[model samples]
Target: MAGVRKRYGGKRALDGFDLTVERGTVHGVLGPNGAGKTTAVRVMTTLLRHDEGLVRVAGHDVRDRGREVRRRIGLLGQHAALDEDLGGRQNLEMFGRLHHLGARRAGVRADELLERFGLMDTGRKAVKLYSGGMRRRLDLAASLITEPEVLFLDEPTTGLDPRGRAEVWGAVRSLVGGGTTVLLTTQYLEEADQLADRISVVDSGRGVAEGTPDELKARIGGDRIDVVLHDADRLADGAHALAHAAGTHAVSTDVDRRLLSAPVADRMTALTETVRALHARGIEARDIALRRPTLDEVFLQLTAARGAGRPGATERQEMPA
Candidate 1:
């Protein structure tokens, strides 16, 4: 999308938004509430109209060729879109038929998808009888009935348990492995960390940052040097020592648990310096380690910048489950 703009009354949902996704990759889109993530996806998937700008999917313009765009893309929304009363195979076959496949072909495709998604054993069981993970898998299979080139997943694992989320995550990996380009919008940062080859951070209806997960994390800050003090009383002394070692006053200390954290550009050098400084100051450390910033941190930094700049910015709400 280029210069895409959509407004609800006076509020702008997308302001000069832009995103470029290469084929056969998992591209994750992330943002806090009301950041225009859902709007961008709706425009790209032809579910909503953009007031202005360019949107092309699978080489077709989304504006004039929405039907063609729909034909090439599959959307698995936040909730499972399945007939709970129908068996897994019946549900898939029904979807295939809706995609214009003949009855014989639909039955054959149902068997293939059932086997592919590991639902063959429960193919004849009603969807309501299936577990949460199984129902989601069936929903995914239904979306794939037409063999789409691009797939759109909007918070695909929102309410699932850990085991259920893992099942869906594994299925997503399998799709990308088989050369399907997936655009995922998720509230859970870890989901994006595990799935996305690249991520776009959106805020205030604009694309604020876009890069690989590691690249984005590097933008906010680098590896951190954390020292867990042996004594709670030494927290102040440890912070001062760490600040001296890190050459920055931006040291954070937790008094109750006695944890001191500081930003470090050079991991080994900082670690060595902090260790020596602690020894010289008669401070005992229970643990000292260097670790990278998490995706959650990146999300906060990006969205915080936007919210700070515009206090009353309109927020987005996901379509109710």
Candidate 2:
């Protein structure tokens, strides 16, 4: 949407927000609290209106043609919506009926979705008895009763444990594998790192950064060579060794963690050289690895960049409306 705008009394919730998601790809929207990720999703899904700019989804404008857009998009909110007293299949069938499918077709669609989500065995089981993962799967299945073209998932995996999160991630992968375009909003950085084909980092009602996970990670700096020293007191020496090996004075040390991090050009060569130099100098290291910057680091740096000089301001420089 161009020049999209939304406000809450005196505050701008979606101030000059802009985003473009391609078809058939899972686009991740990420930000910290009060970052306007939710507001942008609301405007895009037609749940809330934007005071300015244009939003086109599936070739239909969200403002003037909301019904057409709604028909093509399926939304799964943060929490699961399943009746505890009803069976899994019953809930799916009920959603199908609500989507205007006849009774016969609804039953067939429910069974199809149950099998697709690996819930066929528990189809007759009461939803309350289903595990956290099961409930999430059922919720996702309900959203697919009509097989919408674009899916909006607002934190589809929120409070689940590792297993439940994995199950939900698998379900999302399956949907994308079937050629569904998904716009996922979540606070989990790792989830975005794994599932998103591309990610948009939003802050203060605007997209501050956007790119593939790797691309975004690369922007923070370059490959990082990390060394964990066996001796806590050797932290300073380790940082010195890393700085020398990297041919630069840029090195960071976390004394509490006994780790030193530095940017490296030739990953393996720099790592090997550092190891050799440290060994020669008798500065023993517990472990060493050459790796890219983590998503957490990239996110921190990007968000910090947004506030580098300019504090949060009410007015944002305009783009083409």
Q: Residues 195-227, candidate 1: write the lDDT tens digits.
A: 999999888788999999999999978889899
Task: Give all TM-scores, in the order shown.
Answer: 0.94, 0.94
Cα lDDT listed for each candidate: 0.90, 0.87
Best by lDDT: 1
Q: What overall lDDT, based on C-alpha atoms, would model 1 receive against the true structure?
A: 0.90
Least well predicted 10-residue stretch by lDDT in candidate 1: 311-320
Question: Which prediction has the highest TM-score against the true structure?
Answer: 2
Q: Give the worst 10-residue stretch by lDDT in candidate 2.
A: 312-321
Write model 2 residue lDDT over 1-321, tens digit each, in one string.
Answer: 778888766677777888889899999999876677777777888988888889998899999999999999988988788898999999998999999999999999999999999999999999999999999999999999999999999888999898999999999999999999999999899999999999999877788999999999988888989899999988888788888898779898888889998998898889888988799779988889888888998888878766654324322221112
What clash count goes with each model? Answer: 2, 0
lDDT of 2 at 212: 98
Clashes by residue pair, model 1: 34-315, 34-316
